[model samples]
Target: MVMEFPLLEGLSPVERREFIAACTPRRFRRRDIVCHEGDPGDCVHLITGGRLVVRVTTPLGHTATLTILGPGDMFGEQALLSPDARRTATIVAVTDATTLTLNRSQLERLRLQHPQVERFLTTSLAAQVRRLSASVLEALYLPVETRVLRRLAHLARVYADGAGTPALINLTQEDLASMAGTTRATANKVLRELEDQGVVRLSRGAVTVLDPAWLATRAR
Candidate 1:
């Protein structure tokens, strides 16, 4: 079956098939580093299964979680734009994950053969910018609790396994704290409160969202 990628939404069926044919499949185990920040940009990866986190480290050795991505999401697209580009963030697999990667040479050939390829890249980058902008705004104005709730809500949606199955977020308090831009202690406190309220069930290195709808409502 042809896996539908959000980044390839604009491409025609033929174009998508051609693009997929050019890609090479790669897999990583949970907690494996897919790519590191400052690594040479070689290819773009489209997630086929499981989840991954994009993170960046500062000069002071502080790291922040930018986002968690699931099936259909694409990353490392900047490599398609410039040959001199380096990876801007490190990507680590949150679960055993599979991706289809297209190297720069393949991308160049695709762009020449399919005009929609360029459009897809442009759209993908624009969407990322908008998402990052919203994240920045939330950090600047939203309260810590609200930010934490929002992150949980996002994780619930992204890591949802299936209907009638629990939405389990496989991340530690430290990882969640980084995503919410707060301290680990603050994130733990908020999660404990939610657990007390029957909104979530906290366990070792994971959180089970019991009331995802409530979290989504309060996240706003």
Candidate 2:
């Protein structure tokens, strides 16, 4: 299936066209493994449709999702910049997906041909550094409930449709727990509490915030 490559929102028109032309399209079924941790980096993926779950495996072999990324999000970018770098996380399709892929060789060529691409990548890496730092801070200082709330706030801000409506996206409690650095049981209990209070709505794997302002307060 041919899908439009999502252009990075702020890039110049010429840069966008060049980036799209260099990308190869690929499709994945639900639960398909995109890449495994510690494997030599081959390419970065840009989701055109559906979702991808990013996870990291602990030393004990437990895997926890770090995020559920959909269209407009890019992955495996670290490997493109590093020299024969191994992937630090595994990416799997959470739903059937189509993605635009760029191999390392193509990325390197783009970096030289398009200086703007290098600048864009550097900005993304900086943002990742900030996000990782915030996650570490949350793990050190926040309670489980607050951490979960904060994560919900992020999802609601980025993916939710409107007030008193469920997020248009799907995210399981297991995925939430992993992102919030809490147990699934804990995540479930908190979600139930939120539902009981009418602060949010939960059905199946969908979570909708009834009052985003209140949810933000809870997150703090």
Question: Largest lDDT belongs to which candidate?
Answer: 1
* TM-score, prediction 2: 0.83
The sequence of per-residue lDDT tens digits that candidate 2 reaches over residues 80-157 is 777787888888987888888888788778878887787657666787798789888999998888999998887776
In model 2, pairs of residues that clash are 166-208
Q: lDDT values of the candidates? A: 0.89, 0.80
Candidate 2 segments exceeding 4 Å error: 1-10, 157-165, 168-170, 204-220
Runs off by more than 4 Å, candidate 1: 1-3
lDDT of 2 at 44: 80
lDDT for predicted candidate 1 compared with the true structure: 0.89
Root-mean-square deviation of every model: 1.7, 3.5
Per-residue lDDT over 1-220 for candidate 1, one digit per residue giving the tens place of the 0 to 100 score: 2545766767788988998998999999999999999999999998999899999997789888877998888898889888998999999998899999998899889888887778878887998899889988998999999999998999998988768577988889998998899999999999999999999999999999999889999999
Best by TM-score: 1
